[model samples]
Target: MPRERILELRHRGRSFREIARETGCGYGTVRRAYWGAGACAAATERSG
Candidate 1:
């Protein structure tokens, strides 16, 4: 459920700072997840 936890934090509008604190995830990890999601969406749009 690690990915689900990340999405929940995202939906709650938690800052990367807050998510890091709450989830004990590194800042880079949280930020990477966020940006990676955006990149996936962008790639999808380009392909479509």
Candidate 2:
């Protein structure tokens, strides 16, 4: 799944379960992807 789509859906107030259903991915995958994006963004902010 595209990261942008995941972020967009999340931004629209979709839950991880909803995102997983919409994207045809597992709930854990959706949660991890969302959290991983946050972690990466935080790392980028810290680095740059």
Candidate 3:
């Protein structure tokens, strides 16, 4: 749920800090979620 929210916020052009604040997560947490999900998506796209 949070990963999706984080991605949504990112897609809306929110910075990591803003995402963290909006989502009530730490900056590192938001960054990790965004990058981790993004990496997975990229890998899936490449493989697919």
Which candidate leads in TM-score? 2
- The TM-score-based order of candidates, best leading, equals 2, 3, 1
Query: What would the TM-score be for candidate 3 when compared with the true structure?
Result: 0.64
Using lDDT as the yardstick, the better of models 2 and 3 is 2
Cα RMSD, model 3: 8.8
Q: Write the per-residue lDDT of candidate 1 for residues 1-48, one digit (tens) a residue.
A: 145556777898878788766655567777776765422233233436
lDDT of 3: 0.64
Judge candidate 1 at residue 44 and give its lDDT.
36
Candidate 3 or 2, higher TM-score = 2
User: Best candidate, lDDT-wise?
Assistant: 2
Task: Report the candidate with higher TM-score, 1 versus 3.
Answer: 3
Cα lDDT computed for each candidate against the true fold: 0.60, 0.66, 0.64
Residues 1-48, model 2: lDDT tens digits = 656667888899999788777666777767777766432233234435
Q: List the candidates' TM-scores in order.
A: 0.55, 0.66, 0.64
For model 2, the stretches where C-alpha displacement exceeds 4 angstroms are 37-48
lDDT per residue, candidate 3, 1-48, as tens digits?
A: 246767887889899898666656667767777877432333234435
